[model samples]
Target: MLIWRLQKRVLNFVHVPPPHCGVDIVDAIYKCLKECGLKNKVFTVSMDNASYNHSCLRFLREIFSRNRRLLCKGKLFHVRCCAHILNLLVQDGLGEIGHIIENVRESVKYINQYEARKQTFSKIVQQLQLGTKKLVIIDFPTRWNSTFQMLLCALKFKDVFPRFQGRKPNYDYLSTPEEWKNVEKVCEVLEVFNVVTNIIFDSDYPTSNFYLSEIYRVKEILNLKAMDESDFIRRMVGKMKGKFDKYWGECNLLMVVASVMDPRCKLRLAEMFFPKIYSEAETRNNIEQVRGDLYQLYMSM
Candidate 1:
């Protein structure tokens, strides 16, 4: 993929024959870049948080280094996809509520399965005057955001579910009142992730500060919710926070430097937020590191 002046294009799509190892992947990328006369013009490579991807970056970096085409010694050459990381975090949270999701998903499926069931549910919706044109959404299990939308859309019809259960005695997927309450809380939490994911994917070439500020908002929410009195909410937050730290615990150096470079933020955002995210000592050290890295990147240019 190539981006210039806010325009992005996929230059090539290569298929690696089985055993997609780091060497094989790099070879394909190298061939494509050279074919496009972009071998020496390459900058950063953005990919998901897969073990194979790290290996691929390592191999690609060595090849570029051998040709003396590495920028800033390849320090900023690998970018972990933010949307992917956010997806992982949401998936983690969903794992805690899998049973709840399954119940909701099955209910939606049952309602949409047959025309009779659909008519029956719609009559109930109309009787209750739910006034929502949005039908119950069935989610793709693999994509948790779809699950989030499923839950969110389901919440609107929470009042109608139990009523429908009475008419359809065979329908056994209605969530208990307690579980329904938990679902509401879970949707509240997942809403943040859903919004961030949409922003990252919807926008074109968002800057580093744009990424940092959005991620920082997620961090703040997690920290605040981690201390919630409800055990269910706390437990759900725990799983999500673990994944968050895995990808974001150590701030990405490139994003930090880029954030500091943004005129709207400069050093102030880092200085103000570092203390909230890290230890006092760690905060000071990180701010200094960002300062040092920023200077090096500017001087090298």
Candidate 2:
């Protein structure tokens, strides 16, 4: 899903996993990197959890428990996943919106069950599809997307929901307008994919993480005022709400926190946030002096 080939050009990175082939995938990734001759050019590591750290001391100590050989060489950082913090914020938010959340979850279960409803769903997509049969399913690792999709599905099914009461839409159930609403929400996500994609690469904002655009996207979903938004936005939001924010926010937060915790942000962030710092220097001779002075000023802050 990393469309930009971040590993290929990213020089540095962070990884977080609740273990869907986490350790092994990380190893295979790096091994492939070595075969591709990237081992020495980029710094990479598997960011461990609280248990992985509390059972030990210091970053190296925690990481060493996983790969003993890394104790001597190789680079790494063991830090918390920042995006999960946001997921916690959302999960805890259910207490504030429990009814809405439960409704959304039920709607998602309805849509994802089987092909007939899905076919009806596909028909709706064809009607509103603009021009494509291909659509991304609201997936798990994409918690934010799921969260958005859920609410959308619930809203889409609002009309028929009264009929079912508690019957629950089974996989073979025929699609309803409510369900179609949810399907459109998925399309909405596709609509904004490019805008959100830009935030990650624009290098022009105060914040560049994917979630920044995501926050804006969610706000748009929550607040869009098209007449019969239920016919449009709510369904889209339900379809996407599930894991969209949760996963992206979880993963992205880790990256931000890693950047913050690196102790290198002072040096690196300056170069990134202030391009002039590099381009406007008086002389090459003063580069290190300027870098040191800037770093010191940052440290004091």
Candidate 3:
């Protein structure tokens, strides 16, 4: 479900995530909207009845109350995310875990709540500085929490957490064997999303970062060329070859998945998930020799 926000000719979209940062279409829409105008595009606001907070109705209520003009169906609108609805089924019986999870969550939170403890912990960490960086910062702190939690509950206070002996429970009682496994899953999914977010935040993150190091993992998995194809796809893809095998196939299936944050060309980029060449591809004199049959198909067509 989505909140289809419109203000005169200007439209704004926003979302809350579930079933894993799931609103992945807005990327393609933003990319596509430029060449084509968005005046004719129809909006579907993602919604879910189970989530009363971020629902389409709540979105409408908030906006329409602020400005009656938004009430018009021709302009701003709201819809629910089907994936969220599907997730209701996925999390159904598991709702009981929320309270239990919260209890454990608070237990972990208690440690981080005190600044002195956090500082002491940081000092301890600096002593163990195996990496140049102390933490991996993410938009969502789930992984960070898990890492910190294990450090606190299990490993930290083992013989009194201050001892800092081993890796287990080093976070606290927060991360469990179960949570560690889930953390891996969250990392995998979040890693894909972080890549997508980078592409979506192209203006901010810049494609240059993507040309270097593990940062290229997303571009490699998404098999995306910059909106301008500024990066070397063949070379970058070669470098990131096996690093992305985990999410590569999934991205091929879900390139259309983007956020409602920027819907411009996301849909069109979704089309690029397949091998179709853009009509505007520059044709070089050497195209015939380099492309052979591929060139023949284009020329014949």
Q: Considering every candidate listed, which one attains the maximal TM-score?
A: 1
The local lDDT score (0 to 100) that residue 9 gets in candidate 1 is 75
TM-score of each: 0.94, 0.35, 0.31
The sequence of per-residue lDDT tens digits that candidate 3 reaches over residues 1-301 is 8544434433445343544322233333343454456523434343454444344345434533554333233223453332342223213312323332343454445446666555554556666653321222211233333433333333222222333323334454444555444333333423444444445343433232222223234444434522213233333233333333332322221122221113454333333322322122322322222234333323633
For candidate 3, what is the TM-score? 0.31
lDDT of 2 by residue, 1-301 (tens): 5333333245345454645444544554555666777554433343334454433324334344455333113223343343443344334433333443444455445655665545555455565543433223443423544655444434444444434433434433344555455445444543354345445445543342343335545435433522234544444344345444433322222243334434545335423422322234432333454444435434644
Alpha carbon lDDT of each predicted model: 0.83, 0.42, 0.35
Best lDDT goes to which candidate?
A: 1
**Candidate 1 — what's its lDDT?**
0.83
**Cα miss at 83, model 1 (Å)?**
0.9
Which residue segments of model 3 deviate by more than 4 Å?
1-104, 130-174, 193-301
Quick one: RMSD of model 2?
Answer: 12.3
Give the C-alpha miss distance for residue 255 in model 3, angstroms. Answer: 10
